[model samples]
Target: MVAYGFKRWFSPQIQDGTKTHTIRGHRRRHAHQGEELQLFEGMRSLHCRKIIPDPICVAVLPIVIISSDLIDCGIAYIEIDGLPLHRDEIEPFAVSDGFSPDRLRGIAPAALVASTARETMGRFWRSTQPGSRFEGVLIRWRS
Candidate 1:
């Protein structure tokens, strides 16, 4: 149902045509799913100032835009299950635990993350070094 190593631009509805209903696509997509106990309660409410205890999931890819090994200005991330997403490499960090997360809604957000979709474009990812912190638990979405 989801096999985008690159090529998806965007989608939020499900339907084809001929009176099927539920077809959505404007352009903008990426993917990833390798492991999970469950993540995305809305990215666990976006929290992470630094909560290290047992980091090391290393499945990467939550965001990407073609910067390469970021941190030049301090803007590169990858803390899935702990929410830090902002580095895509053919975005594919949510299949082993894929359900949701990596959405853009009506498309419009870039005060931090960027994209080009190759799964987002030129990825190397970052984050998770605060003593290798990232065991899990940071997805929050309540609405």
Candidate 2:
């Protein structure tokens, strides 16, 4: 399973089905339809303090959003079917991972990055050091 990590603040949006697509900063690995992705909390002290060892959700990658840029180096949109983790189930795992609930307060929304995808993005993220290359890549769903 491909594993992706996100910040804690954004977990609620994923859980509630408000946020559908994740706009990645750089193009990572190619994601196929129906691929299962494990979503966990990343360890970024600035955004989220707690590092949720266990994945907060499992999602299937159904679509990948493309961009109009001539030189697109990163994925534009990552559509997922995310199922939020229950607090009861996650608490035990959190403790085992060396984090306590008390330390998780007031964090920003979590960002997600698939494991394999992370490798690809990591390269780009490092190359573009000192500044984030995240641009606006919007995908509009048609009903």
- By TM-score, who's the top model here? 2
Which 10 consecutive residues of model 2 have the lowest summed lDDT?
A: 134-143
Q: Once superposed on the true structure, which residue ranges of model 1 sit more than 4 Å away at CA?
A: 1-90, 94-102, 105-108, 116-132, 137-143
| Residue 143 shift from truth in candidate 1, angstroms | 18
At residue 117, candidate 2 shows an lDDT of: 34
TM-score, prediction 1: 0.21
lDDT tens readout by residue for model 1, 1-143: 12111112122211111111111122253222232211111232343122112112223333222233433423233443344555452244321122122443234233223442222222212231233222322221111
Candidate 2: tens digits of C-alpha lDDT, residues 66-95: 222233333232222233334343333223
Clashes of each: 31, 9
lDDT top scorer: 2
